[model samples]
Target chain A: MDITINRGDFVGLLGPSGSGKTTLIKTILGATDVYGGEVRVEGQSIAERRPRVGYVPQLETIDWNFPVTVEQVVTMGRVRRGWWYPWQRREDRLVAHEMMSRLGIADFAARHVRELSGGQKQRALLARALVSSPRLLLLDEPTSGVDIKTRDEIMHLLDELNHQDVTVIMTTHEINAVAAHLPWVVCLNGGIVDSGPPADVFTPDTLRRTYNADILVTEYMGMKLVAESPHFFGRNERGSADSSERGEHVHAASV
Target chain B: MFTPLQYEFFVRALIVATLVGGLCGLIGVYVVLRRMSYIGHGLSHAIFGGAVASYVLSVNFFLGASVWGFVSALLINLATRKRSISADAAIGIVTTSSFALGVALISRFRSFTRSFDAALFGNILGITQADVIAIAAVALLAAAALFVGYKYLLFTTFEPEVARFYGVPAGWTDAGFSLLLAAVIVVSLQVLGVTMIAAAIVIPPVVARLLTDEFARMLLLSVVIGALCGLGGLYMSFYLDISSGASVVLFSAAVFLIALSYTTLRSRLGSARWRRRSAASGKLEPFH
Candidate 1:
């Protein structure tokens, strides 16, 4: 997919389960090989822009039983020394503590990370990503297993960060989560099926093209939402909910 | 026990056991935590090939075994990283082939086979001052590497992709760790032998895992368990006239079993007590 993510833009990369969202993120981080196209950050290739990019991996990607404290995990973001030096400077510790407080996890700074809830885990990871003060932050499935309230809180946190000029590009399988909160949503299947403001690209036809399944798209309070159509479960009585029609039931509650 | 310590060889053996035990324990935490216990097993077996080759060629045992073990570790790592080969398959192939080659080579010469028993099962009782120094040197190097890279090592062990994303050089970290594991295995051969060196690299961390969820505490606990196991095993071997390597492994396994049983029993009792208290408060409910 050909795309450009500008600074301070909160773009959510939306896709189905088997889509290339993770592959794209890995490619951006230079952790995987990019077969065809070039991925540049601020006119530089991803490999060259490594220092300016921060990453918050999915919660499941970490071994929570690893026995590291919250503050220690956040302090790993500092890039001041090579791996040969394991010590964290006082300034780095201060920054990590400050980030922990900002994320509302200061109370658990010395607690084992496995003791955290899913929401707290995501916040801790976010704090780690922000501790280094990178120009661009990349998150993968930040709210996948979190509760609805926690999901909203994470989205709000991302919005607040974006407003403060830290460019963000997070990937998620939840389409309505992106459509409701993200100003820009990139629908990704094997490639970018569509990319624009939510209103421009969150249509039923666009979602079907991206997901390769019939999806219901509807409007609620001037906002677009997407969900799997009820026809998929052999209940063909209700066709795909297009934007113009309002169903009796709220088919896309995620919005 | 006091009289045995008066002998120089016994003294050297104790020093070797103490250092190698703590060293293996320190490195073993990563091995256990990363679930790379099989790699340690594979490399330990692979070291036999190098031991046999160096004996036949009249070279330094440590040099040959370290080279072979190091090469085998890197090869196993490479095979697992490939898309086709599974980790267990890679380990099975590399370790068995290397060990088989060592056996075949030794069987060709009766003179070589005569001295192979000590190398196979270990001869800690016959440890020399040179062996002590070499073990001490490798132990120090391993300690330095771990101390310098503790944070990066922990980060990469738990989350490689995240560490790579932050420019932690995860690939280099992994390669360095593998080399360190190889060196530790080689140093451990004289005390634990090729057959049981992997156990020394695995058991303590496992016991610590059962006891604590914190990494730092796990490291400290694993080191202590290893040192104690070594001292106790050596004493048992001295008194019983048995194999020190086997004794050490048995001691470690016994400790692991005790820890497992204790933790399980405590959790069960704790839960049952909670249930009784809740029942007394009339909060118990029936299942559907």
Candidate 2:
């Protein structure tokens, strides 16, 4: 997949499981072994870009009972290029404090990350990623395992971060809830199937190839919504909703 | 207690046992937290092989045993990380084989003398002033490394995968921890014995965990609990005519039981009070 993510681009990687979405992100981070093409950021090579990039791992992968306060978790990102130490330094603590305050988690700085609400947990991870003031941020399923309100809060935070010229790229399973709202989407299976604005790329042809399922694509009030037709056992015999339609379901969907 | 203090050997044993206890507890926090408690047990058993090898070659115990133990520690760590072998299988294979080597060497060379018996159980009564100094030195070195690598240790322990992105040298940290853990086990051999050392390393931290949720507090509490256990155990051994290592481990077990009971009872009482409040209000609501 030969694709370029410009400095200001806000892109969402959308695909089914085992779609190489995360591997691509790790390839960019230089964490995985590569046999072929190179990954470069700006004028620098792969190794140089990893320190400059911020990555938030999947929430499910985190050890929530780690016994660290939000402040400690935030300052973890302050161990940038050459610095490695036992505790957060004075300036690192200040930077962490500032970042926590900016994320509206200042009040919870001393609280353990385990005690955080779903939204606060996401924000804490965001604060940790942002503490280094990276020009680029990469998140893996930031909205997964969160409620709708929390997901919206996370997306709003990322949008705000992107607008500030942070250059956000994230891999998400949330298609309609997340990728459809983004300005750019990369549909991938084993490789990039297509890439464009959501409205341009979210056609039934492209989504089917990416997801290998009949995905219902609808637009409501200019927002692209992607969903799967409900499988009704008896209703399937009445008429396969997908069977009757080539592109009719796009218009057939109601508000 | 005061009469036992008058004996120089008793004083030396006391000092060495206390230092060893605190050091094990200090390092044990990482072992227990990382779910690598078996590493401590496995490494101690492996270090026994190193001990025999050192004695056979007439090498300095610390130098030869440390290098041997360090290599074994590294091997166990590497094997576990590869994940080709299950953690228990890896530990069991490596550690038991190494221990068997030591047993074979001991059985083969009958020249390897009295300390071998002490190594199995413990020989605190036979402790020397030099042993005390060695334990203190190892304790200091472990403490200094922990102090310097505090953040790295915490990050690696808490989040190994993510810590690397922020520039924490996770591999080096793991190697260093393995080396330190091996050294602690080796030095603790005389005071706590191979049989009891794992408990000394594991129990204090575990008891502390039940008492507090904070990491720093847990570390401090573990160390304190370990030191006090050491002191109390030694006194009990002297008064009750028991083995020092056995007394210390038993004391630690007692503390763990107390902590578990206290936390469990506190939570039960708290829930009962909350239930009373809900019944009075005639509605389900949050206790807080």
Candidate 1 pairs with clashing backbones: none
In model 1, state the lDDT of residue B73: 86
lDDT of 1 by residue, B5-93 (tens): 98887777877777787888999999988878888888888888888888888888888888888889889988988879998899999
Mind giving the per-residue lDDT tens digits that candidate 2 earns over A1-255? 699999888999999999999999888877887888778877677855555678898888888887678888888888752355566789888988888888789999888888888778888988999987889899988888889988987889889988899998899998888998999999999999999999899999999999898878888888878866776576447564555554445453211
State which docking tier applies to candidate 1.
acceptable
Error of 2 at B92 (Å): 2.0
| Weakest ten-residue segment in model 1 chain A by summed lDDT | A228-237
> Each prediction's TM-score against the native?
0.90, 0.91
In terms of lDDT, which candidate is strongest? 2
Write down the DockQ of candidate 2. 0.41
